[model samples]
Structures are given as C-alpha cells and as structure tokens.
Target: MSVSTPSSRPSASSSASPSVADLVAATPADRNRVVDLLRGAAILVVCLGHWLMAGVHVDGAGELRRTGLLGIATWTHPLTWVLQVMPVFFLVGGYANAISWRGARARGTTYGGWLRARLRRLTIPLLPLMLFWAAVAPLASALGVDGGTLRIASMASLVPTWFLAVYLLVVALTPLTLALWERCGWWSVLGGAAVAGLVDLVSVGGDLLAVGFCNYLFVWGTVHQLGYAWRDGALPGAAHRLGLAAVGLVGLLLLVGVGPYGVSMVGVGGHGVDNSYPARVTLLFLGLLQAGVVTALEPALARFAARPRVWAATVLVNARIMTVYLWHLTALGIVVGLSLALGGVGLHLQPGTGTWWATRPLWFAVLAATTALLVTLLGRLEQPAPDPRPAPPAVLPVAALLATCAGLAVMADLGIADADGTVNAWLPWVPLVAAVALGTVRLPAVRRRGDRSAPGGYLAP
Candidate 1:
C-alpha cells in the first residue's frame, strides 16, 4: 500500500462533538488525502446531480411527478458520464476495506467480528431515514396525496439506500472475496468480468430478466477486486492507470455508440430498462471508465486537497456522507415543494428550455443551501456512536448483518412500504437492524484483545 499508517485520529465526539473544522484538523497527516478528496467530490456530485436533474411537477390533483433531464435532453449523456460515481466509491471502499481488515487481523480480530463492526456503521445510519419515511407515509396518505406520486416519491427518496444493501453484501463477503483474491489474483476480476458478459448474453438472448440481476456480483465485484490490486500495488504506475482509462473510455463508447446500451449513466425509472438498475454491461463499462478517470485525477486532487481550506471542506463533507445521501432526496422534495408552492417561473418550464437553463444556477444554489441545512440538522446521527460502555454479546453479529441486508434488499424492492405502499413491510429490517446495531458491542476491538499473540496482520501476497 502507498499509504503509511499514522497515529490514531480522534473521533468526531472524543471530548465534545467535533465541529467541521475540528474534524478536518483531526485528520492524520499520513492518511490518504486523495481518497478522501475523491469521496468528497463524489458525494457532492451525486447530490447535486440528482437535484439538478430532478424535474418535479404537480399532477392535476396536485402531487409531484418526477422526471429527469436525460429523458428530456438527449445532450445530457456526457454529463451523466462525468457524474456517475458509484464505481469510484466501490473501488475506494475496496481499498479502504483491504487496509482496515488487515489492520484488524493484525491485532487478531476474527472475520465475524470484523464483519460485525463494519456492517454496524453502515446499518445504523439507515434507521433514522427509514423511520422518518415510515412515519410520513400514513400522514401523507391521510392528507389525500395522489397514491401514485406518494409511492413514487417514497421509493425515489430511498433509491440511494440500495448502495448500502449492495455494499453490506460486499463487505460481508470480504473475507471470502479477499481469500479468493489471494489465491487467484487478478484472475478473480477476470472471472467476474466473464460472468458479467455471460449474464448480459443470457439475459438478452434468452429474455430472462432474473439472470441480468447477477451483474451486481459480476460487475461491481470485479471492480471491488480491483481495489485489492490497487492496494497491493498490482495496479502500479500512471501508465497503467491511463491505459485503463483509455480502454474503459473506448469500451464505454462502443457499448453506448454501437451496443444497445442506454446513453445515460442513471436510468429513468418506469423505462423498460434503467441502465443503472438490473446491472448492465454499460455500468461495468462505467466502472472501468470512472476508475480510469479517478486514477487520472487522483494526483491533482490529492495536491488540491492538501490545502488546509480544501481539506477542511472535504472533512466536513466526509463526516456526514450517509447523512447527506439520506437527506438529499428530501432536500429536493422540499425545494420542489417550495418552488411549486411559490409558483417559481423556472421550475414550471419544460426542463430543457432556455429559461430552465437560465434558472438552474439559482435553483442549484437554493437546493445546495437547503441540503446543507438538512445535513446540519440530521448529519450528527451518522457520527459513530460513543464507544459502548458495556459492549453487547459477541455472537450473532453476522446473522444480524444478513437479516439487515435481507431487510434492505426487501426495502429496495418494496420501498418503505409494500407494493401496496403499506409501511407494514417495515418488519425484520427496521427493528432487526436497529436491535443489532444498538445492541452489539465493538466486535473487532473486543476480539483483538484476546488473540494478540497471532502473527496474522496483513493478508498474504
């Protein structure tokens, strides 16, 4: 790994809760600034991307209908290419997981324990967001909101939550995946790619929708494996990174230009095939293309992030990542609701019109400000919970994580409510995930103490 370990940085709530400035100051000098830079930029791009693209209008009876710029303006494909950042997040996550897991194992942590600690952080932040949605459904339904819009808005708001489900599955399988990487090296990635191609072929040729879903593993799993390569210096040199970027660019162009792939990185729902969903080869190309872009930009971004002011901003953004993501859709909803109530001129126009273009800057500014406020108000919930005074039982962490994943997967399909839009489906996940996250102790830390004599820190080369 290029990154050298530094002294432990304090938590956001070490003494009193950290201010954004304090959080920035607390970052260790030896940590990977470039990774954090990429993270910060990616999060903002995602937030603003949705806000800028979202076109909401009232139905005749008055409920917000969501639309996107890609459907409206065919010229927006290049922009989607620039902003689709999920691949970068997964790659960085792979790298980060490699480092952290090695660190934990060095101190002799068990796979189960390490898995528990990892999944807890991911799941805890979700409860509040889901709970808020759960609470709102009945009230909104009672107020006579259009059933279709209510359903669409609720599901749309939680769209980002699918990443958590996917990520948790990845993290849960990390020990196994890492082991596969150890034994097979880059062959694992190649295998995944092959599987992905086969999936596309089978799904497309056979007219089987279920088979396409397997791309989640074949595509992202391959990219995640690349993170292992990245951490171990297997992906060495600017030439390597640039070559990847170049090839990925060509591959993406071929997929979109020649293949049946949709041009947009994000899929507009209710369309026959949302490119982002159901895992297409196009997204795999996106991963390749974006990974190359990330590598190409890393050096410059690292240098820029080293600036004290820039670093501080990055820290602030990083601190509330899940919080920001969770709240961003709500921010859009609020802004759209307000704009409609006020009868804002720009928002009322067709999305691609010249007047809409002129009004975007102001609209963006308004959305950003509103999102910041929402983050400020709820972001703290995402901060790591105070070190548990008395840790919970060591057993069942993985099981809990699985239940959580299942719940989230279900939620992704059904939204906060069932297909009928009843919040009753909130079972097994909301309560189950909450109980595990809150009730569980610090699994890794607790495990590390008992087995300090082992010599198993970093994974074998």
Candidate 2:
C-alpha cells in the first residue's frame, strides 16, 4: 500500500481557523466517528469479559468446580475470538495520538507539553481508586477477612492497568514513532508486524518478554501507524478497503486455524505463556480487519452518527471516556465486595458442562446494576470541570499524569525494594497516596477552553 506524506500546510479547515479543541473538533467526522465507535466497542467487550471472569468461587467440599460469576473463567477461552477487542483499542489510540500530535505541532506546543496534557486525563482518576483499594485490602485483612479473597480482588482490580503502562510507553515515544511512520511509510507498519511474529517465535515458553508483552511495541505500534493511514486516505476508496479487510480476515483465520498460535484471545494462565497475554500478531491482524471494516463503512457510519441524539450521546460520553474506562473495573469490584459481604452471592457453575448458560441473563443483570451504581457514584470523574476554559499551554495538566504514573509505578515496584531489604512494603503506597492528592488538586487546570467570568469559576454540567 502507498502512503501519502503528512501535509505541512494546515488542513483545509484549519487554514482559516485557530483553536485547539476547535481544530481537534474539526477533524473530519469520519476519523472522529471511527474513534468513538471503536472505543464504545472496546469498553463493551471488556465489560463482557469481566462479567464472565470476575468473582468466580469454588466449592470447598466438592472437587467439582463450584460456581461464582467468574466461574466461566474455566471455559471462556473460546470467546476470545468474539470477545477480545484489544486490537481495536490500540487502533483508535493510534488515531487519537496521530491527531493530537499533529495538532500540537501545528499549535507550536512542545511534544512533552502536549503529551503531559493528554496523559493527565488518562491517569488522574486512577489514583483515588488505587489508593482506596490498597487501603481496603490491608484493612480487610486486619479485620479477619479471607486473605485469599482480598488478594484476588486486588489482582482483578489491576487487570486493566496493564494497558495504562503500555499506552504510556506509546505516548512517550510519539515523536519517534511518528517520525518512523513518515520516513518508512507503510513499510514501517509491516515491519512492526514482522517484529511481533519474530518475538512470539523466539519466546517459545513465554520466558522472554513476559508472555509477549514486548510486542506492545510491534503489534500495537503497527495498528497505530494505520491511524496515519486513515488520516491520509492512503487506504481510501471502497475497493481498497474491501481488499484490505479480505486480506486481514484471511490472515487472521489462518493464524487461528492452522498457524502456530492458539485460538484463544482472552488469556490462558499457566500455559507457560500466552499471545493474548501481551497482545501478539493475532491481534495485529484483528486491528487491520477492524480498521478496514470501519473505514469501508465510514460514510454510512458518519451519516448515522450525525443524528442529533446519537451525536449528543457520543459527545457526552467522549467527554467522559476516561472515567468509564478507568472505573468499570471498580464498578465490578463494588458489586463483588457487596455480594460477599451480604453473606452469599449464588453462582453455580457446572464448569465443562456449560450448565450456567441459562443463568447468564441473570448474571448480566447483576453486573449491569452494579455498573450503574458505580457510575452514578464515581461518574463525577467523567464530568468536565465546571469551567470549560482550557488552561494556558504551559499550565496544561502534565503534573497529574506524571504524578499518577509515578505513584502507580512506585506502588507496583514495592516488592522489588522489599526483596532487596531496602524499603518497607508500605512505603510504596505512600507515593500512590501522594499522587492522588496532587491530582485532585490539579485537575481543575485540565478543563476545556471557553470564555470565563471569574478566576476560578466553572461551567455548569
């Protein structure tokens, strides 16, 4: 495929106008809608997978697998083909990064400054939730709660955070990655795919690179380059789109059916290592297929997304996408914790027999209800600051992102320090607490740009 170089001149719409959000807002509807639809799809899939995998309990008396909501963990492996949407997540991410980077360059914002601003939204709210859980786990243990249960809950809460780390790496390298895209064109993406495949082959027993997580570079990096493709219309026209989809689907099918890779996409622990664990080449194929399918249908999707109600809802959610993504896991945890505290939550899983199929409807209702409560209480994070006015360039929200990531990293690294006998386990949580405190105080500076009446005034939601 041929790649069109990024134009140095401002895009047609930008040539006559000057505004940050406006420029971002004015990005072609086709690209914007693609990001929204992909995000919506990714979140939905994640929720589905979580519903199947959270709060699974085993029977104490019977060797048979008793049931919990997470009981499906035993057999949900096959659903990965239908349920895993990681590829799309990265694809949309690439698009967002490309747009943001382009806009930042146009506005003369430094790369570091532009990134810190975007990263703040992604990292801020995570601070409070992480601290709340860190405190809760220790408190519950002290109060005689089952240690195993508390550990499980903590592990589940940290599941989605892997993406945060990988995404940060991608964001931090935006300048270099974009430069590669510009220099090598489509070949850069192909090279990424090749690198991922090579890593998977050499890793063999999952010893190297932590179950192919290293491919976060190659697989995700490849999909991200396609965002550049989307921007340039390099994959334009119906015929080209269809051809790309066909090739991607055919390649993906071969991988699952006869290639060395396994068919499952969610994850299989103790299998030595898993491709899905870190997102490998198989997911790269999915990204290509998803992007092609979305691009081919962009015109139609744009028309549909333009309806007043539909567009309004998208705008509202887009405003809060970070909140929803970060908090959905918290939502499930609340339900699980509540259920456990209330004495018992009925979950009967026959395991391999798949007898729980009928109960799925009820389980889904419980999860939905739990999510609603979580959203209502924590959704405040989704709201724009009362003042829609964007902070000045220098004041953009880097502190929040840097503060939160550092905190989480420190928290995660505590065991290392303790193993070396150099630091206390509890010391790590201190950074986490400090990060959240700083973020809460700094978030107001991250609002959108608009006219302001008073120095610290906010616009009403």
All candidates: TM-score: 0.86, 0.76
lDDT of 1 by residue, 219-266 (tens): 788788877877777767778877877877898888777776777878
Q: List the global CA lDDT of all models.
A: 0.68, 0.59
List the candidate 2 regions with Cα displacement exceeding 4 Å: 1-31, 58-78, 205-211, 269-273, 348-355, 383-461
Alpha-carbon RMSD, each predicted model: 5.4, 7.6
Model 1 vs. true fold: TM: 0.86
lDDT of 2 by residue, 1-461 (tens): 11112332124344222222332343343345646755765786787776665535445542212233322354555566667777777776776677777777887877546654555446555655666665665566667755555545555655666667667667766778888888988888888888888887776544575647678677877888887777666887988888778877888888877766665665655432355666778888877887788788888877887676665556445544555666676566676677666654554354334566667677778877776666556555443233333443433334544445554544433321233223233633643554445333345456444312111100110
**Candidate 2 lowest-lDDT run of ten:** 452-461
Worst 10 residues of 1 by lDDT: 452-461
